[model samples]
Target: MKIVSSEGQFQGINHNRAMEPAHQPVYEMVTRTRTRTRTIAAGLVVANLALSGLLSKADNYNGNNTPPADGGYRAEACESAKQYHYEHAGFNAPGNTGGGNSRADVNTDTNWFRFPVNFQVHMLSTNKIGATTLYKAQMDQLDVTNSNNGAIMGLDPSTNSTGATAVQTNPAGWFIESFFNLNLRQSLDGGHTYTPQPTHVVLTNHNPPVFAMAPLLPPLGGRYGGETNSKIFFCTNFSSPCCTNGIIITNVIHTGFSTNFPPPPRGSNAVHTFSSTVSFNISMDNGLSFSAASAPAVVTVSVAHRTNDLFDPDTGRTTMVLDTEMTQLDISGGTLPAGVKLRQSPAMPSDGITTILSNGPSSYMISSSFNIMPELSLDNGSTWIPTCICKRMKHIPPPDYPSTCLSNAPLGFWRLNELSGTTAFNSGSLGPTANGTDTSIVQGDPGANLTGMGANNFAYSFNTTAFVDINSSSLNLNTVTVAAWVRIPTGFLSAIVSRGTNSWRLYIDNGGHAVFQTGQGGAAASTAPVDDAQWHMLAGVYTSSTFIEQIFVDGVLAGPISSATVPGNPTIHTQIGAAPDGSQARFFGDIAQVAVFNQALTAAQIQTLRTAAGGPPSSPTPVLTISPGLGTSFDITCFFGTTVQRTYSLSSSPNWTTIGSNASPYILTVTPTTNAAFFRLVR
Candidate 1:
């Protein structure tokens, strides 16, 4: 590949510098060895000798003659190669150091090219020269007929590390040829080795100007099924004689190779050589094959151009000329034709051309230069959605059920129950801490009946003295949402979760309403009582932009109140199940499935959390009736479903203990010892 600096300087070749006046021959002839290598050496020697003899005799062997001023010599000698260089002047070649009037004044500096090849690992550390081989072949004077160009590579995300599958472009012959062969090679061991696949003729007598490959992030379903895929894009000039006349067309070929790729006979290969177009070929199976190319999507843009002043040595005349410049479109969005969606991560600028290092499924990054806003899809590439980088949040559901919310790539998440030690693991960077005593993990609440009541579960029980605290410095959220599944039997004013000094508080009010209070003096109360002795999903939202505070109970919006003021910056400790100040109003309940979001959640996200925790009850809410039974005892009767557990606390600030659990309906007699004790049912 050619390497040029932004300043128009070729890496090894000196431009605009006069050649040595000595009359030595400018071309090197390769001696044919008995080695069995027929691909490169033999072809190069013959082509170089023939061109050298013709140019040497014409230029009088001076090596310093300038192009003729009349541009007449160019028309005669420039017949073979568009990019070839002559030892002596008189022929105006594009970007030639020798004075010449050329049509294309291409920027030799800004254009940087990387050859498809692998560097020997051992040669990397030492100064020793190691053997090198082409990752993909390109046409040169040496290999005139059997040459490949426009080589690109992509990695299969699903199989990247252990034994990754790599796909690369292999176009045969020169662009000027009448027929062009489109081929590909698969490498089971990354790009260290390759196996040539079947070749297909994409165009007859047409020039495929460019080729590139990128891994297609499979749709969410494909990811679930352990499948991976990739795409290849090529721009073909459909104009007559190829490269000189018709509109440039771009098309994509998709391949799926993961083990779980869809069933065979998936889709047909698409080949269109008319008009300027952009489209993709989709593959349902992992790179095993692809479908016919989709209809082209028209993208209107002027063809790139370069201008130069050519001086013909023979005529001593200078003329202005214009030449077509090759352009590349680096795309990174997840939108494709035919309603397929692929999951995409946030746009990363370096993802436009993926390398061996950054080619994993979940870990890959993507970016674009043409203001192409990178989007991701959950269905294959059919639809697209914009996404931002979430910074500070933790959403932890039960272990067994995969969370769709988390799949959207949240800032941080931790299944509090899945954690041990003082540190709570966050999916993102910041990890919170579980501090103090009196906190213990217990049996989790039952799941929503839709998926079986006890399918996925886990919970954290907090006594009056117990609480979990996350450092305020770790998370400084302005607009925020904190949600949890909680159960409190007989609750006075209690803080379920609080951060900073009056910054935000989600708690049960003295009257048993779910209340959310923000520093902005905005307080929202749920329409229904939450401390009714059963499990309920509650969420508190504070949006600084709107200066509003809201409360949600069991997926339904309870109250949305507006206030001009917003909470003060949370610069102190953030605590769950207790006040941030360590004052009164400690929570006394069973808390499960807590999520803290850096941004205020929408109504839909809150409902999703409610469903994930355990959806709203299917039957009418059962009333807990406590009445005096026989001597010195009170009987507690309530409707029970599946496996609800009953627990009671003797003292107002006492540690609660589990009493009993049953699937059948029955009346339980509780003998109370304290004057002010509480009883509650939990699921």
Candidate 2:
């Protein structure tokens, strides 16, 4: 017997029905295969390399490279990009790249495509895409400079031009290891291969042949055959900090079939079908600004479940159209903080399809869409904008920090401004104008602009107004709280909030903590160390009148300074990125989602704000949410709350035994080593 129509709307699904209380489907097992490549020490090779240093003793590039005579690089989008490339990566884009699902887009020249250098991952999923596995690749940080290696230069990027090569040499002793995660779960082994399991789940890697194992599936124990999983990893080392920046990215790609499980014993009778979906979540304070986002790919999955009739089971048709409906939910503006925002737009090939499904009868498909984009925001939470809206800094360029050619620069957690008009604090009557000169410093020389990872870089004008003011009156607080997402690309840094004489403002020190300097002489009456490059949310609360300051990192209160005070009503000019105090600790990274409250928030309020941002604090005091999946036993994510801790792991099932614990984020094995487990913030 064949039939007709099917439709329904759902806020979320429940698995129960009838007289008996519905039993939630118990997770059979859980497993995770994590691949981590550490920073290896570069073996020093005594190759007396040809020297380009002007100084016979000190090795450094000549500080005076003529910047394209007249900034002539500012031609068409393509030409200017070309000059930027020559000036930075020192290479040209390849002509024709064989077009396909995995091939690079030659026409766009959008993202950097290098042979064997980048670790490309593709995923295929059966369930709506969730926070899947994270992908990473680490190499010995290599410093790029002219033949001389004397001057520290970056590739000058054209506004929104992803092709421009903007390279920045690391510090003298520090190494740069780039990292991004696989938020989407379509293909794991690389886009070239994919494996869909009977359980309707996807694996972490898509490499063909070993097609038998699923890397990111729940473990199978007392049930049928125990599950199988696999992973890959590599490491590199750099001799000096100057050339130690390497690429690490988390690929969020998913492709797969649909699978539905039987309703639990007594719960709701709602059968949940799984389909793949992609989303992004940005954070200001490490995971403090947890904001969910969608990618810009319209993926349609037409699913038809296989079923059989009881009485006429023998004669039942092979294909059964289980009553199902696939629809898109715009969760963008749903429930985030007042200063948080989100977006999900369609990708390249405009529009697609809408399907018609039937409850039971002729097999029909259920179509769905996955609309996501390079999400962007201007004001912390006032308005949401496209990634392109925040133009590239006039001086900073592409393949440098956090974006590709086709997409807008990622703020990561930092905030950026679109400089179409001019600066607010102008020195001359003519004011800040972008006329290809030192006066304006419109997008040209990397040496002139400050570039951060993703979107923290800013173009300066010697014109102080470039520093947005944040005073007691502008952002007053007797009992105040200050929060910002920052990235220090490189330097002996200091990001000032206000520069005053007697009283004062706050900032981030070179060591990565919050610093509140007050009472004249530029002394840090109150300061806390917080130096990791990843975006960190630092809250400084001057509760009551006395000089009592409590610092909170992520959700846990870091060390506090009891004698911290803002020397009473003192006038101070605010500086967002760099400290205006002649010390010149210009932030080399992005700053975003900045907020200053008049009143100090309790620990609970901060948690609520983080929850609204999408980052729910982890359990216990220090170990924040490393990784969380509903009923799974594996954990992913680095823990920063503890200065003495290395790695962390969690298990939801009592039967599941702990493998091992280390100080690194890569200790929890993703294999069936553990049964079904769920991990959450404990404290």
Candidate 3:
């Protein structure tokens, strides 16, 4: 809970070099088979090579040429794993081609290794790679002991010591480990067991090191659960044992590219544009130790990429800019440890590559126009939703009856960071200067700190189980009507659910107006401020036959929240920013089209749904273009020029004209008995 750590921002946005996203080539880099190597003899010797099926190697323990054996692995801690590969990948063996991997110059053969067994990296999935690659699994050199103790190096550039082993725990060597893909792949029967590519075995440090273990708890503790506490980052210089360790991973595996297109020619249409940057790094004493000095994994990393479009020869749309960065340690002071405390959790499940389009026409749209879904409000700006519908429901688990349960939120209980703001949940400001104020900008360097620094923006952490089976189902709502779309900005004072009790809210009241607070223990409260910062469509209705409780701001009728009874009871369970005293006022500013109705809308149907909020009471929001025209489609009826009573194109131009007393240009036009005729309209 020590959060609030500002100081990293690095916006650079030029992005326009565009033209290298065409990968498919790989015609034949090298595809040989039949491989084998063996030549061992002496002390405790154990050799029994067979060729029947081949694929077995096990004897790992080369920490500087093996020596610790009383159970194994400790030979002086395996010679610090060759000082963790010369401080962390600067190359010194096999084929040295150093350029920008500098840890501390050492080239003796890039030593310090170990892999008797355990290797499964896997990654692949740019939706199947069709086109678009930026993979960064970072480092690898599997040899899991035996099978001729192999060496699959790649990442050449020009070759110097490609022997692959700078050991900063295999630092970016095998050149980001052969672009990821080691998940066992079929082949293993020799010994040391086998399971490497991130196969759950860690300890790669250089000095001041301090590794411990114990925390598990999770679907296997692949990490990323309430986190607990973390901080690790190290990379200084190494050619072979320069010493200065770090590695304590609880779990780290991230991949989110927004664009890298190049694979659509058969029928044409291979669009690719990527954007991903939501960074966060940590590793305190678990994996062994990490760098950036440790203490920065508040949970970042958001990405989205997609492609698949082409009709005849049209493959346009492709613009990517997703960002996320973390690796801090420009330190100057010093004071970190005693009981060890530093946590993070505001959003991180890891997902990207959305809708590559192209299954139909040359279409593929999911840009939200470009706002990207910002509008957050963790109790600061006021209220607003739509940051992909509030992150599609980050975890789900908030309305817990009375509150008090956000230990780490996320599935086990929900509360995915509810809402916060440095902007960009779709509020614009991709970073750099659009209003991020500069701040140093470095969270990932796309627009500049897209939302990373100091507790990462402030509030927002919800999960009310993502709203659905509020305990099986009982949502009658009582006489409903609740609308949204707000933006509060100044000091952003509370209430998008100030928890009046068994809750139901819509807030904004630091004088900016807009409020809706239904009851329970707080006495059924209600407000309708409508402060006027622009996007307004606040509502609140509860007429149960005039039980009174009406307040509409943007749709007019700015009155009636005098509530004496409508507290709510379809079974409680409703929370968005929480309030009624639970603690975190959430909901800062920006929400779009929120609704809840069981029936009880009047004051002109609540100003016709606030003049159709972003659209859909008639016109634009309703699309059915043409579909019901059998026999003229039943006396055909269509209404909606502006809520001419809502109803956009009803069919039945055939017959059924009751000719009632309530008419609206009743021109009565009917014909045919069966060809298919039927039309009726009422609001």
Candidate 4:
């Protein structure tokens, strides 16, 4: 989630300036470490390193004084469709994702990235597993429109239990990869017409360059001899030795299981043991045209610094954007390198950071958020149940479910991305789903070239006369918060989500301002006009206890609030895309990611919602604290990342440029021509 400040749209705060956010960003610039570029010994030496412990360093690989080639990486032919057999198999592989990293020119669009992220999808709940069929997982993160910038994100599908692999076999395997010229398809009819409706499928570009291996999946299958897809596996391949190639992997995902195996417990990981490596299957070929298990002695993925995986061959720079929950990250590296930077992105995410260790092989990226206890999600992200919510859950979560899971759970979430239906599926578990009684499609941002609903990226297009109405009793509120994304054309006026007359409404009034009004008294705060046919996230919080209405636009507080106190609870049914009764000015655009919270969401929580759409915004330069040291030794500090270069010149009006990271204790001849000295860190 990045801070999205449309220039001239935000008040006071400059979206162009990267300032120290409320979520203090700290950067330690110890620019006295190592040279930025390391000239590796010529000739490609493909060698594989072992995972964990100390990584293997190829002899004569670093420091040969021979500059690395500027040619970017091009993957090799699928290196044998055969599976990788355990422990240490060195068949000419680069130590790292060979090459360097350059941030000079790279695409960060949501549609450009094809990450082969093998992640876990939890769907079955203990309550829904008995005397019936298996309940599949539903995600609100995928599907939406007008996604200008971000990454084309997705995960490889592993066998639920089919046990499919490249060995001409069928617990299945998966991979996470990147794709190009990707196509996302939709259908209106029940799987028939191409008129376009709902559900997203990544076609043609079936495989994309993989970024990282995600957390593993738990054991599948039910306890009462229900379902087969037991076991999980992942298969990967190596491309031809090129300039840039790498894939990061997180540590094992299944924890708390009584030994990665079965009696299976009454939980999600009940079918197989942790030791069972039945799912490490890969096709190296274009899909192996068709690809299982037993805890074979597998190769454990070790921590490797992938700073070598350069986006550009000519440039070698490493950059990591700071997140709200960014921990004190110690980027393990040949420190003080020229291209390494822990900088703040103009698009700052209220969510969290992606921690990368840059000292070894391929840098590993791991989410810096607190791990929540594994629980049950009956409906998308609407509700959650703790205390061992998987199957046959007699008792497995130990004492009980962690508070973290429930504390952040949503009461009702509607990711209105349906293909052909009058029903707007409430991915949440609140009450019965609200029904759209008119013609409206959950298809926005269509076409292969356009960005699809990237895991909660798209929205429901209600350009016609259609609306979603929910029963008032279902969402009766004491403490309320309503949030949703809207893209309205000029002169469009309606509610994104409304609670009835004089209640709480996040809408565009006739005045054309994005407003959040609450309390029985109808106190409201209207931000700048947003009827410019662009997407915006509006969140409204009304605390009956505080008798105040706080509104946020794009995660930042709206115009100043002058409250006229009013006390009372908000009641009445809720209607989305239109006012109650479905008449009187419908929102003439798209609406998505509508969430109704019983608890008033904090500013941080709202920021998470505001990150629904992200693109490159202007970044403010960083400010540094400089302090002169003994003699010529100088020190600098700031809440910033990136290299700090100090240039001294004997001539004024001299051409200034970044210094090369060539030597430590930087030997200066100190000729008579070198007299004047001035220093400032430029971002």
For this target, which candidate reaches the highest lDDT against the unseen true structure?
Answer: 1
Give the number of the best model, judged by TM-score.
Answer: 4
Where does candidate 4 stray beyond 4 Å? 1-33, 40-407, 433-458, 520-526, 562-571, 581-584, 611-683
Question: Which lDDT tens digits does candidate 2 get at residues 583-627?
Answer: 545455445444555555676555333322221111211222233
Candidate 4 local Cα displacement, residue 220, angstroms: 33
Q: Which residue runs does candidate 1 get wrong by more than 4 Å?
A: 1-334, 337-402, 407-414, 418-425, 432-456, 612-683
Would you list the C-alpha lDDT of every candidate in the order shown? Answer: 0.36, 0.27, 0.26, 0.33
Candidate 1 to truth, TM: 0.34
TM-score of 4: 0.37
RMSD of each: 31.0, 27.1, 26.0, 24.3
**CA displacement after TM-score superposition, residue 414 of candidate 1 (Å):** 4.4
Per-residue CA lDDT of candidate 4, range 1-683, in tens? 01110000001111123233322222111000012222211111111111111111111112112223542211111111111111111112122222221111111100011112111212222121112121222221211211222222221122121100001100011111100111122333322332211111110110111111121121111011101211111112122111121111111122222231111111111122232221212122222221221122111111212222212111233322221121121111222123322211113211111222132222122222211112222243244323110010010111111121123565667767655657666655464544344345556542111111244344677764667777646565657788776777764557778765555677776767777766446456665786777666677787777777787776667776535344233456678877774434777777876777878788755543332232222132233333234666644433334334555652555455554232221222222234554433444
Question: lDDT by residue for model 1 over 279-378, one digit each (tens)?
Answer: 3544434233554443322221111111222232223433221111112222333344335332222332111110111222222111101112224343
Candidate 4 Cα deviation (angstroms), residue 548: 2.3
- Candidate 1 vs 3: which has more TM-score: 1
- Which 10-residue span in candidate 3 carries the lowest summed lDDT? 1-10
lDDT of 3 by residue, 1-683 (tens): 00000110011111121111121101100000101111111100111111112111111112122222221221111111111111112222222221111111211122222223221111221211112122222223322232343332122122111111111111100101111111221134544233222111111111110100111111011111111132122223322232323323222222122333332332222223333322233344434444432232222223322122211111233222111111111111123232333222123212211112222221121111000112222233243222111011011111211021111111112112223323212121111121211111122211111111112222232222111112212233545556544444542445553224444455655565565545532222224444444445566666556556666765565654555355564544444444434433555443332345556566654543332221111111110011123464323222221111222233453324444333322223344454433233433
Ranking by TM-score: 4, 1, 2, 3
List runs of model 2 lying over 4 Å from the truth: 1-419, 423-466, 469-472, 491-493, 510-512, 520-529, 579-584, 615-683
